[model samples]
Target chain A: MADLPERVEIAEEGPREGFQIEPGPIPTADKVALIDALSATGLRHIQVCSFVNPKLVPGWADAEAVAAGFSPRGGVRYAALWFNENGLKRALAFRDRLSITGSVSLSASDAFSVKNLNRDHAANLDAMRRMTAVHKAAGVPVTRVGVMAAFGCNYQGDILPEQVVRTVADGLAVAQEAGETIADVSLADTMGWATPTRIERGVGAVRERWPHLRIGLHLHDTRGLAVANAHAGLRLGVDRFDSTVGGLGGCPFAGQKGAAGNICTEELVLLCEEMGVRTGVDLDALIEVGRMAERIVGHALPSELLRAGSLDAFRRKQAA
Target chain B: MADLPERVEIAEEGPREGFQIEPGPIPTADKVALIDALSATGLRHIQVCSFVNPKLVPGWADAEAVAAGFSPRGGVRYAALWFNENGLKRALAFRDRLSITGSVSLSASDAFSVKNLNRDHAANLDAMRRMTAVHKAAGVPVTRVGVMAAFGCNYQGDILPEQVVRTVADGLAVAQEAGETIADVSLADTMGWATPTRIERGVGAVRERWPHLRIGLHLHDTRGLAVANAHAGLRLGVDRFDSTVGGLGGCPFAGQKGAAGNICTEELVLLCEEMGVRTGVDLDALIEVGRMAERIVGHALPSELLRAGSLDAFRRKQAA
Candidate 1:
């Protein structure tokens, strides 16, 4: 309905975001195979793993091995999520893109911050600054500073738009002071509270504050608005999005069960394609990869495209 | 994003479309209770049930009893679906609004017509004309002419926009010849194959042909684009949408299972509310009604809103 972006970049996060909350352990070989299958589908960027504590997230215990085992394809960026200097050091060994994760709305709800990060608001900000400086010194090619709970906090009902702008501004100022050229600043809907209007407003506020910084959306399909919110972002000229295969991942911090997860990769691509936006993805291949992910996960996924198939799915049945 | 309509109307079809496909027979009192619950949620229009053959849709065996049992609330329109003279006569016993169903793309794919209606294209049109003549003689107050598979067909991949326009023209001519003033003409995506661009193009074509006619959309969330396509239609100024509580109903004729169903009522309302579009339906009450429907139907529904709860679902959890 609106003027869509010519093309959008899909960042695969199933291996990292989706797998982190899964109670069952996924073998490193399987993770690598999943990433490889995703790479073959022409996905240009994949967050293959996260460098977090093995005890905290058992699913990501072999993050380093998964990263080391991945066969990088040309033009595809392999990235990892890091929370502290140790995680960053582990990620630096094999990372093309490194992410420093923090929630900008930590101050809005201290209860969530304590449960989610085990740190207070000021401590989280200080850690974010220190992490940004360390990443700058390492001189990684691409660094994404993610502001989780940017749209709404789980403990906090409705986040004020000004708080998001302030967080982005302060984060950008810290990164700039460290002489780091930030590649992207992501707005993470950790609890899936983002609506289209909220997404538009949040994106608008960030763009107004830091017009030069590239913005990305890391959305969850908790209330079935991930794709809709993604569309809203696209209308506002956002081109980069984080999605998980088979709509995997749960919000451990929010104590959410298997209800809400990352936006499904195939579903997002289909949304863009149906809206006449180019995603540079092979839908059929992506669906196949999604099926492989679902099988490996040992359960049915939340993706509609994977379940419904393509528009031509019934052609053969009808012909027969 | 885009400028949304100031307000939109949601027509609840849980009792008719949702129940028709449910294999397990629901008690007449349960269906009545579900409709009564929905009516209390400020939903002004509810398609209570259809007057189709009880043998055809065993789930709707007590349609007339359900209609008789419902306590009609003020400002709510209780409607029924009717196909032929017998069904019309049944509906006429307590008529509010009647639907005359046929696809605009019937000629494009006779296989679908035969499978869905047990009649070919020409025969379906002739039946539609005859039905319209009978409706004129009975002098029903409101009649909705539905064009099933207006965007895409299960039998034939993509139905052209021109075919839809021609069907509407022909259907309108028949109704006019019979001296019956049609209240609404709806584009029904029975197989959930409608896309956003296709929806925009189809709605535009119909508007160009019949500028004065009230256009409505009957969408299925099979590919999860029902909401997106609804948004597209909203952008083109089509406001009336057919939704079911808990996103119930599967297409029995198309042989689809658990994929294509009516757009979930609460989710649609949430989408509209988030986009600054006003829907008078109460979200909390509607979600409760959805849960009641789920309980009576004895299964988990496809509604994300019901699963995710409301935006404030975590407030109590956090407090505890």
Candidate 2:
């Protein structure tokens, strides 16, 4: 309890995550509407769109339109995702609207790196070095290191906490050689193989080694244990999370169909608020945004809170 | 980690919990099949069906047929749920196959008692007393005290740890007056108002007061924190749990439609098995049964593990 944070910083990835895999041209205006609705909630950070090849990810072909379309609210930092130089250039085009920072992204498992990026750890680090140069050229500060499959990998077996620590070190080394100071590390449960014990070990190991760096968990609910994993991270004082409203996204490569996406933002808020951890996000307002996201997706995403509603609503009704 | 139990006792309630709320006249044979399948999953205890009024709960009208239908396997303790003498009489008819131990079931919230059972706390106590007498007359051992709405209530606001402790004491007192030596208590998150912190506090309070009686948790996944709460209980060494296969039930009166039910059996097994705690149940076998449950229900159930497959499955594939 003493280790839990006073508040958590949630980066909403619903717009980027949902549109990336939803198998729709999902009208660009609806996407902007959902982002606008989310902006109205007290969420201070939102990822508005993904800048990727329109041919490969047809759902996100209108990424530029979504980036420019949504009404950005003051005090909220809007971000975008991109992989290479070309994608970064597209994202930079919206510098006035998007919070343009860069990340040194690497994978802990060599197999996941090969499968997801067609590169092993060595080759991925070289790519990160080049990406770091690109960010510097574009004047984007590279301040975060995201280690994918930091908990475990589906292609590889159980991931050791040491492996995660090593991966973070490798990413930090890449940034260090480029004169970039990494302030935080985000561990991605990219394949959803994380259990609470695994989280405690993984997060514990990283925090012990990098005592000054902020740690975040980017959890996927592929196995229905995301909230538990998040709770485990919170217990260890990991104060940053990446979530999707209504659990809006799915992993295209988790080796199974119907695999769940990120942990739902509203559920995480309820968990934090119930535990006396401040989230700075309005619970009811976020829930309403979750419902709106569900409508835009034209299907129910994986959030149970969207259906059952926040406990505060019932508390209010009961008080009445 | 030292406080976590090495092994746990899971009371399988899928057949009863699922059948009661599924809006089915879900064929008695199908219900029997699910029970028979669960029986083979290494789960020791299973609640087969609820003996309730037919008109009110048309789904469980064939409770007798379901009771007489399934083949009772060796070493398995099968149980049934009942609220009054008629329901108890119906269950006693199949005492040769069912485990007939009774429970003093009461709700911590008067508002929930009134809304759910048409009685306040005091009246509900009288009803529990009457039910206890009925159990004693039938020579049934009332060995467990169950406190529903033990964590929180929708009709009444948040339930405190002290309130839960008082409710447990009230139920234990009822059993004591009837000369029923209770050995264990089960606290239910009846309306799904529990978070991990609430769980720690409630479980902490009860364990503090009794110190000798065994404690278990019956968690609903409403609002999606059931698994996290279960994890919290595991941290405190609560070794008994009640779960439904495929997350196979819904809270009909959770003041909302499409509310999720109990913590998933396979998900619980995954959480325990991954944490080095032993849950004799096989993950692959349980996931298969969860699929079978989905087929019987004619829709997807809430267990994401059903779709994602077990981590062990991926491990085997990876190893291969």
Candidate 3:
């Protein structure tokens, strides 16, 4: 790869992460249209869908159909999230036009891992390692590995920095042994509990331990600190972020009652642009996508930019 | 008055500061119920309604009726905001149970003042002084004198710190001549263009100029930095804040089309509680009030706590 410019990549998550938490199934055609619209907004990396069991999460039941309909554009990467080897096989079917990615969540707290993913810490790590080996042999790129709940877990509360550092080292070691070079390593504030001070410490520790690994952030707006936390990460020189259009998606462990949404795409873009960081996404286009997502969900989504529109919207109203 | 605890007083603005922004008029009964609900949340100060010309702001046409409906309880001080002598006369009718407060807005740029208040900077200051004299002779306890647009005005662009300082000195000098001690001086970021560095500079300059005058903050969330700016003010030892419940208000100058709402009450409460500052407001009750406000508005309000409900809401869901 040529020297990557110092640009912040906003990894759009409307398909996999945003859809998973939705109560009812969104049709495959609508999902395709949503992804197609989002891709046209110049988002370089888009997580199209996840390869989980249809019975477990009905929202992504048509993941394969949705993936098949995606038209790859230049310099853009379409990816799907998978759990075990079966899911990995399903994702590998789109290898010609897309990059297949696998995720294993390691919670700093065991209770959260078991409660959320229905697996303890050791079992989850072991499954991830096996999947890594299968993907390596198939020559499909495993673009990312994320450590969810690396900050304080909702169930366990106050996850130590030492635990997160140890988990990153263990996951990196497993991936290396399987001959899979990790494209990116992300730390998620699974419950939106990480502060700027904690983020600085966590990101710093990860960088010191694995100098070659790229770091990204996956944040929730549970405490309304997601944007501030993302800005803090940027200040520390970490570029990539995971956001859902209209700030859709919530934790399953948090269940139906949880108010936490993904950090909003339009708001994130506005923040980046104001700070002089290049996100390569248009605010107006993202707002249009956000409104569509709101319609699909049958409820108003949590994005402020969509409701407020843009400064141009205000200017136009004045002109009228 | 007995020595009040050196506590930070955040006055809720759902009724007055918030309501005036709505383009269409909300029902008087709904307005009364909203204030009644907010009053029950244990906020020490609540700006209940504004006594502005009904022609200028149709939403506040029933200010006197709204004030009459409010029955003050222990420690809660219901207040009404007045812009000039006629508004103060309307405010004085509720003097038995409500405190009357006055506002003067200075534009760092002269154009904003003309556009927003229909006067230049000097004329606005003159109007404020005249209102102060009328307020003093009536023996109404003036809890606060607010200076709006203390930060940069949207029309003028950047406001000089020296302009802010001079405005404060002038307001203070008038209050002294009237023989009524100004309880506190509030600086508002009417547009949410303020950064932490600017906040620190503004606060530091104001403190150095008038060390004994109590200072407060009234911030907007136009750029998603209201909470961060509030935190900066708190770090500078500012104890009072003016916020609307559910973050209901926006600047008319931000224009009608794309204005952002005020900072949500739940987010502010969470930030303050986490920092160990006492806001003396009940979080659960405040969330309930936010929901009520949403119902009244016929659409969802911008409150984060209302959508997320409370931590208690999550705990209950987990229990189920």
Docking class of 3: incorrect
- Tens-digit lDDT track of model 1 for A1-320: 56678899999988888777767788888899999999999898888888898887788889878887888888887877777778878877764543333322234344456667789767777876776666666765435556778888777767767887777666666666666656688888878888878987888988887788789998988887787788778878899999998888865544455476888898889888767788888888898999899898898788877777766456666567
Chain A alone, TM-score for each of the models?
0.91, 0.98, 0.92
By DockQ, the best candidate is 2
Ranking by TM-score: 2, 1, 3
lDDT of 1 by residue, B1-320 (tens): 45467889989999888887777788888898998899899888899988888777677678788888989888888877767789878877775533333222233356678877789878888887777667667765435567887887777777878988887777777777776666678998878778777887888898888788889998888877777778777777788999999988865545455575888888888888766788898888888998888898898787877767776456566567
lDDT of 2 by residue, B19-120 (tens): 778764799889999999999989999999898998888998899999999989999999999988999999999999999989999898989999998999
TM-score, cand. 2? 0.99
Clashing pairs in 2: none
DockQ of 3: 0.22
Q: TM-score of B chain for each model? A: 0.92, 0.98, 0.90
